[model samples]
Target chain A: MILYLMCFALFLVGVYGLLTKRDLIKLILSIAVMGYAVNLFLILFAYKKDAGIPILLEGVVQGSMVDPLPQALVLTSIVIELGTTALLVALAIRLVQKYKTFDITKIRRLFG
Target chain B: MPVETWLYFTLGFMILGSIIALEIKDILSSIVAIGVVGLGVSVAFLFLQAPDLAIVQFLFEIFAMIILVRAFVKKDYHAETPARVNGFLVAISMLVIIAIFVSSISVFKLLPPFGQPLFETAQHYVDHGVRETGAVNLVTAIILDYRAYDTLGEVTVLFTAILGTITILRIRNGKNAGRKGA
Candidate 1:
């Protein structure tokens, strides 16, 4: 479907930026973009047309709700992503403070 | 208008935002572009009847926005020298990427069609989640009751991440504060 293709293209655009970008923050942003694209694709892929929310509301019929599995998976992944982004940003702060630069190629002083 | 048509339109906007986010030179502008992409995706999630994901995504965008703002100093982070990326290498990489995506699409054809539950176990949860877990939301029942162990691990990861951040930043007791006091 065009929708799926478009999402994949967006993901590839993120990958392209990740490959080409020099700044660490930009690289991080690209990674997040890629993750977002994948998450969106997964949720949409699991979605059934005309399905309502997964909640069992009063008097609501069962078996007609959208899939809840992907929603739960996305929730957990989003939290994990928050942790990762936080850790990376902290590392970035340390890197910038120590090296006085954001270009990753220039900050290669972590020798054994 | 059909919801699928709306979904397509939103996906197009999201794609546009994604391209802009990656292509723009300014970091601040790039941040805004990514935010727009997130918003568009969240809207699409809602359209697909995943309100929980939509809410989480909406909040996640805010969280990411805060992180970007926190990192947003006026310092010049731009690399003065242009990157020497080889055109031929990039072309090859793109080709490989396209191949992977195409293969994935073909494999997706093997998956259960949209809206159908793939597993019988999941169907049981869908039917009796509220009565069993006492949670009205099926997602809550799944994550909290059926997959409780996974949730526990997720919490542990979150805790460890907070610890790692603190360790990296040393916001708490600095290295050898006890020794100095002694």
Candidate 2:
């Protein structure tokens, strides 16, 4: 499908950003982009046509219900993303403090 | 025309957007592009009948963008020098590999089809799991009870990461507290 291909292209773009970008902040941003792309791909995999909400109500049953599993998984994944972003921000702050600049080239203290 | 045609077009666009996001020189622009990718993905999820995942992906995508922007405020967004590599070759090779991988999987139908026997077993687990484990969500029941050991290991790994971060961030004074008294 055109939509699936578009999603894949977006994911590849994010990957390219993460791999090619030299700026530390940009690198982090690219990585986040990559994460978003993958998450999107996963969500897209579970879509269905003409499905109603997954929630069950009394006395009225839906003929077709949306899949609920992916939603729960996505919620957990979002929390994980939050944790990762927090750590990334903390690392960026420390990198700035130590190097006095955001340029990745100047911050070569870690390289052997 | 069949709906499949539109789906194919959207898929192509999604792929194009991903490539652009990665290739772009501007970090901020790439971040925005990533957001677009997320939106596209959520829409795809809706089409796939996975509303739950779509909602979660939407929420996480927004959160990630905000975090990236906040971290890079007043910070340099470009690399002074690019890494030395045969870019074209690498890209070509990667594309080939991905094509091969995708084609192989699709051609062979490697993934288990939905509602197969395996899925039935999984469904059974979900149906009876909560009653046995006292967990409300079927997935949660599986994660917390059926495969508890794996969850425990993951928790340990998380704790280790936190500990490492704390240790790295700790400030070392000139004199140790015990030696200061001596």
Candidate 3:
């Protein structure tokens, strides 16, 4: 219960950073933080007390094991996050080249 | 110590690292701080009995750190002015966030209690996963066999992201191309 709240708090911190930060790099960092929170949440859900990893071993009884579903989901999500982060970094690099600044506030020509 | 204690500690470190990452004045230091947080999450994954996730997370964190450091090196700006955030807006947003978090706690109560997951199809996966997929590791079985479509979608997403990155970065700016070597 408390753990879940803590995860949510971490997520809110990311959201706060996303809302308040002006730097493009910081924005990307916040997105990464949010992704971490979500991945942690799913892993927490799959956990079981005293359970072994989700693998079937020979000569060992299948007594108890953590859920494999969420683990699979998180696996896919982690790779997807990697791809997005690369894409975002590429975009940020282009932005820096064009504007000569990492600060988002200075790149307001689109608002005009 | 119980696993919960270790989990609490890891989560605390992650939260603290996240705060430091966001509040740090130096962008490079902030990137390092975020990397620590990512590693902490990977540790938490190991503690939760998900070695597969822990391994993937470890690799992902390394690659992510490399990319972030490269971005920092390529950055044009040397002077980082402290973020000038509006105090009033921060306060309002904090209050709203607190309210939403409190409300969500009630929703979380509907979820299964810690360490006691309510399994439906997951039970079937555990019982028949090895026989159906011939994979000893149920997670691998799920990813590569039962839920193969998800893997396909993930691969497609990676392809698209790579394509987009290549396309965005390959553009030769007419004016800046002469000044800056791209």
Give the better candidate number (1 or 2) by DockQ.
1
Those runs of model 3 whose alpha carbons end farther than 4 Å from true positions after fitting are: B74-79, B178-182
Two-chain complex of model 2, DockQ on C-alpha atoms against the true structure: 0.33
Superposed model 1: Cα runs more than 4 Å off: A59-63, B74-89, B102-105, B112-120, B171-182
**Cα distance off (Å), candidate 3, residue B54:** 0.3
Model 2 lDDT at residue A97: 61
Better of 1 and 3 by TM-score: 3
Highest-DockQ candidate: 3
**DockQ-sorted candidate list, best first:** 3, 1, 2
Best by lDDT: 3
lDDT of 3 by residue, A49-100 (tens): 9999998889998788999999999999999999999999999888887787
lDDT of 3 at B120: 57
lDDT of 1 by residue, A21-104 (tens): 777888888888898889988887777767788897888666577778878888898888878888888888767766777778
Q: What tens digits encode model 3's per-residue C-alpha lDDT throughout B103-137?
A: 99998888888998776579889989888889999
Cand. 1 TM to true fold: 0.87
